[model samples]
Target: MIKKMSIVCLMMLFISCVKTKEEKNFFSNGDFYIDYYENEILIRRDAFYKKGNLKAIIEFKNDKLDNAKIYNGKKLVSQYFRKNDTLYDSETYYDNGIVIGEGNVDRWCREIGWWNYYDRNRRLFQKQHYVILNNSQLSNQVLFYKNGLLDTLRSDIADIVFYKDKGGASFKGKLIYNRKLNEKSYVSILFSDSIKDDFSNMDSVKFDTITFGDKAIMEFPVIFESNGRKNIRGIVVEQYAKEENVGDKPVNMLERYMYIDKKVDFH
Candidate 1:
């Protein structure tokens, strides 16, 4: 994704610009609060709460880092501008305040141009193409389908698809968990319905929906015959790379979304 965030922004571009002569206005360590005046740079961080109120707000000037906002109580959910060290303008929100993920950044901070993503009832799912191909920097994204059609989100597996504008590749499509869905956000992979149709030559399938730390896994679709490939699948779930051994709990079940080929278990 964005080439591993440009290799972690070239390995932490200056931390907070260093400097540090201490011209501070305010700085806290309890939860997060900063306002420095060029002392060490950074003007805001951490304090991002929700439900319990007091979302976010950070501002500073004489030190080069200014502007910040992230709220859920008053609405606004994101805002940014941490110049100099890079990270020019960023935005993201969707708890009702709208605005999913606008964009900015470049001057080497990376993530530049056309970044717009939405879908909390706002539609327009994705389209982030932060160019600069040969010079190195890149981003390339583009998905949509809340009816706007044209979708394809597969930046390395757990696939996703939706198409049909008119051009012929066969038209008429259907496979999003077979229609009527809302599994709370979905996470159900359970494999083995007689191996679903075999699919050799290295079978594959994925509808993408992953996250394991907080639990939200959905990567299913692996049905390779010849006596191998089944059980759990990738997205970062090691198990000898698999050939069918699966059992210790981890599960995935989201068929018809067009790739969740039966042997589910993201262990």
Candidate 2:
């Protein structure tokens, strides 16, 4: 008789947790309530707190998570827009109706295009740009401060296919804008295989400062045959609002390296 009663209680608990094909499921505890639909292609759930205050609400359409909103104590904090489970666009609030940050996501959910960020006071604090490079890889990202001040442009992986059977390791640059006239700049490239004595240009070299129109770029060739380790460390100094070569300061520098066990291949 005791074993039979225990089995019956377990059966009742299981039944309460799930809904039958012809029945709708609802559960509540004081200030919390939830509704579940089991027969839909994509089951949906709606939850609420005291006085029907929506804690979270997900509205699905045609078996897809179309849209959703999340709240904290009746204050909407986040809102998301999705199609087929892919988040396309979304916005987050600071509980005072201030948009914190908003941007677009690619199909793979990698952040793409323009992303806007705001300070707690709702002022435009920063903006970032992401570029999809070769083979759909996210390579370049440029960030700007308020009022279009160029902060930094970084390309973490600058891999490029040189030939059918040859490749090299590379990455994007740390570009800085030189606003002064005839701003001179040079870059130093450092290769990882450098030893204490007798190093060639492939090990390290400092190029002379050169000027360019609106911007100047320094490049060094690092060729490798056997796979080991490779790197290029560079620095760029420019005269900003100072006399020729006077008060010149390094505006930006970059150091990127990668390992190559085989030839570079894109296909």
Candidate 3:
């Protein structure tokens, strides 16, 4: 009777394993499949196309984004990691598995710092330095040629000059506009805790009311809050008339932010 009981227990365990396997393989809503740990925490999410081709694989830890890999059929197109859902580092590959672009994206979903772009032959063709501008949808980009020279022809920024005086260090930037400006356009320079992260507590120090121009020059004196390094942010606000068919939209406002870093010089 004891031997018979042991055999029955083995059969039940085998059945349970088979059931779990079948659930993992076929339990899907037709587009994606999810797997969970024993504690019901989601471990992996596999997304598929309508024809059952795997599209993406996203992994999570503690219910937050950890890393994600996107694919085009059997080829990996891009992969990125969001540690703690804050920092984003991403890399994209060509269809032939050659790395095309790689960069870090800030919490605001804007690309920050330096980003490299490669040609199809795996050679570095260009580099871009992205900074927060007044318009959250847009970023000021400083471009570089493959030979490491500044590519001003392709860069959005014209010129930014910094200087030191008796009061403190100050900066001025020349903005070249593609179209003529009106009276509603202005540039504001502010002091902020960070140049890239958050801009809520910024203190405006200087502003320029630009009217009727293809170019605007904005400058402000820098005031260091501490002896350590700090960041300065400049915002260019451009306003346009209300467009038709846009429901209740008063004005089209576009803002961009330019970032600069300075350190206290005791000498």
Candidate 4:
């Protein structure tokens, strides 16, 4: 009799578990709160229309949204937001399921900014930026592209230098090619404007080219040599040639280098 009673109790427990497998809650308006289980553990919850259209879903990992939650409407449009244990910012789409816009919190500034735009298809486009400023007087800005690319950026600061003066005051200059790395161009500008009178006509010349390869190394032409220990000289590109390897073809290249001099005060 004792063994029989034990078996009957085990059977009752199994039935109880099965009953909980299909647990559901219904709202007064007829929306159903549905849940799914795996091995007697709740794994998913969803809300459904009276007509059986899925409206919203909350996925679970130990009863948390380990992945993401999705909200849907009667028109079959759906939007999803990533979640850890809480709902983060998310983007929403139109009835056609095309992304319309998205917004998120700026934890630093506690201010929220959102963007609304359009795509080539005339669909609504949107993005957002949140600013958190450490300094009250300074402002922050963020920029984004339609393709979700970061294009350019600028920020406000308390101090910035518009001009700098060392021993002498102002200088005027034009940029010219000074060197080449591979096929890339590198240029330097010669300052033609200064307050000193020591600069000569050689300083007026600018634009010197430097070639890089096995055939041509590098060369320069001197414009002016100072009389003192320090030389204030202008330089220009002359010519260059690279030696060929045993099995490789020979390569030859040439470049023009120029130099410009400006007045300089020694002391």
- Whose lDDT is greatest here? 3
lDDT accuracy of residue 255 in candidate 1? 27
Tens digit per residue, CA lDDT, model 4, 151-243: 433211111112223434432222222233333332322323231222224334453433322332222332323322322333333344444
lDDT of 2 by residue, 61-143 (tens): 77766777778877888776773354458677887879987876544555655578887877776665554433253323334
lDDT (tens digit, per residue) of candidate 1 on 136-252: 554433345546755443331232232333553332222232122222433333233333222222234432334322133333233233443343321222111213337875444
Over the stretch 78-189, how does candidate 3's per-residue lDDT look in tens digits?
A: 8879844566898889988899989887655567656899888777777666654444534445555656565655654523344556555543333443222344455443
Off by over 4 Å in 4: 1-20, 67-76, 81-83, 87-89, 103-127, 130-267
Candidate 3 TM-score to native: 0.57
Two-way lDDT contest, 1 vs 4, winner: 1
Number of colliding residue pairs in each model: 10, 1, 7, 17
Q: How many pairs in model 3 have backbone atoms within 3 A of each other, for residues 3 or more apart or on separate chains, i.e. clashes?
A: 7
Per-residue error for 263 in candidate 4, Å, reads: 45
Stretches > 4 Å off in candidate 1: 1-56, 59-62, 70-73, 81-84, 94-99, 102-111, 114-116, 121-124, 128-267
Which residue pairs in candidate 3 collide?
133-256, 133-257, 134-255, 134-256, 134-257, 135-255, 135-256
Better of 2 and 4 by TM-score: 2
lDDT of 1 at 91: 78
Residue ranges of candidate 3 with Cα displaced over 4 Å: 1-30, 106-114, 127-136, 142-146, 158-191, 194-225, 236-267
